[model samples]
Target: MTFAAQVAMFSKLAEEKGMVNSLEGNLSVIDRQTGNIYITPSHRAKCLLTEEEICIVNPQGEQIGGTGKKSSEFFLHEAAYKARPDVGAVVHCHTPYLSAYAFAYRDFETPKDTFLSQIFGNIKCLPYGAHGTHEIHQGIEEALDGRPVALLGGHGVVCVGEDLEDAIGIMEAAENYAKTIAIKHKLF
Candidate 1:
């Protein structure tokens, strides 16, 4: 599947899994061959997102293709791609369990589960930043420091992976892990 299609599909999956609402998340995949970034558009419903609505931007964040404007949170994707050359895709969402931690300004501690601990190493909640501003991306690299997922303080979660499937899987795992923590604390 094309990167655009993959993004559109996983975006819908995110919505179906309660990772994001219709207009509340963004997903992007960097074409390994072209270096073009295909991302979800701003102000669109993920549940109904289509491949045609995907926007393309160069590595420098300039629009080079597609009809819709790039997402306002494009800078976060840019930072992740720049910081981690191995990352081919990014998934950002306001999942209820994870966002609860963001709202509380709390970081996650990897549970005793061996697999979860290996996959997620104590996700950090970066300091709050104003959306659509550079402030929102400040310290993002450090927050992502060798980790696939990071929580944007008072914002949401951002995850990176080698590809669209990998990114989406990481997002699902992260959300489920957060839910486990919430259940443990009776926060649900």
Candidate 2:
């Protein structure tokens, strides 16, 4: 698939899975040959973004193409790529279950059920940082070590994978398990 098509497909998947709402989430894929990162634009609705709307940015976070601004929270995605060379895609979403944990600065436990447990090992909730700032960049860098998924304190969730499909699937499974746990806690 084309870069924009992959992003649009993943963004739509995230939205359908309840991991994206409004303009609260973004995805990025790195061009291995050119090293340019293509990220979702900041101001568009999750479901409304088109392939041509994706923004290409350099390693230093400078915008090179696409209309409008790159995601203000681009640093989170950038940091993931910088920290893990193996990571080709990053997906960030302000899904409700993850957001609840993010707001509380709580770590996520691997679910007791085998299916759910396999989706997450341990998820760290990084300390709170203001969005689109270096503070957030530092937090993401510190929390992303040795894990494919993490919850950003008071922000949302960030997941890294070999590609967009892997990244989005991990986020979807992780977030759904989180929501299930939340509902279970309410019952018990």
Q: Who wins the TM-score comparison? A: 1
Model 2, global lDDT:
0.82
lDDT for model 1, please: 0.85
> lDDT of each prediction vs. the true structure?
0.85, 0.82
Q: Which parts of model 1 have CA positions greater than 4 angstroms off? A: none
Candidate 2, pairs of clashing residues: 102-154
Give residue 166's error in model 2 in angstroms. Answer: 1.0
**For model 2, what is the alpha-carbon lDDT of residue 172?**
79
Find the 10 residues in a row with the least total lDDT in model 1: 14-23
Clashing pairs in 1: none
